[model samples]
Target: MYISKKEIEVRYAETDQMGIVYHANYLIWMELGRTALIQEMGFSYADMEKDGIISPVIDIAVSYKKSLHYGETAIVYTWVEAYNGFKTTYGYEIKTPDNETALTGTSSHICVKKENFKPIQFRKYYPEWHKAYEEAKK
Candidate 1:
């Protein structure tokens, strides 16, 4: 599988009262990872939006394994876990500098029309991207 990596610096503002990274921050990091993977695959979400197509997360699941502190760097690895013409599931792993997994998750998304919220067939709408995801999943 082709995995894309993104490095993010943990900011103090992203931490909670106990000085550890808040759980909600993982969602943002996952997005960063997804963006990196899409860019690596030579696709741009902005371009999709321009075409009146919007990809939204239909489901997500995350598991936290370790705590992260401010001033630390987070390494996010992302890949297409599954693609089935209608839905694409992206897998993610957030790791520490030592390469230990801090969080693991998957986010499933579906493409929809911007005008109506109606789901669109991804393969028909973006064959190239669909192919990329299919290949990446393997």
Candidate 2:
């Protein structure tokens, strides 16, 4: 599998009253990880939006194992977990500098026509991107 790693510095704004990172912030980190993976594959989500296609998450699952605090750095490791022409699942792992997993998750998304929100196959609009997912799945 091809994994893309993004290092994020935990900011104070991302934390809660107790100073630990909030749960929802991890979702945002996951988005960054996903975008990093797409960019690494040479595809731009902005261009896809300009093409009138939008990919939205249909489902997500996350597990938090350790608490991260502000001033700490977390590395997000992302990869293609599975892909069909219609839907793609991306897996992620957020780890500390020591490589200990702090969180693990997967997000599944489907391409849709922005105008109608009707589901579309990624292969039809972005064959190279689709093929990259296929290659990464192996």
| C-alpha lDDT (0 to 100) for residue 67 of candidate 1 | 89
Candidate 1 lDDT at 83 equals 87
- Residue 18 miss distance in model 2 (angstroms): 1.4
Query: Pairs clashing in candidate 2?
Result: none
Q: Which 10 consecutive residues of model 2 have the lowest summed lDDT?
A: 129-138
Task: Estimate candidate 2's RMSD in Å.
Answer: 0.8
Kindly list the per-residue Cα lDDT of model 2 for residues 72-125, writing each as its tens digit. 999999999999988999999999878889999999999999999999878877
Q: Candidate 2 at 130: error in angstroms? A: 1.3
Displacement of residue 89 (Cα, Å) in model 1 is 0.3
lDDT of model 2 at position 18: 95
Model-by-model lDDT, in order? 0.94, 0.94
Model 1 pairs whose backbones collide: none
Q: What local lDDT does model 1 show for residue 110?
A: 96
- Candidates in order, TM-scores: namely 0.97, 0.97
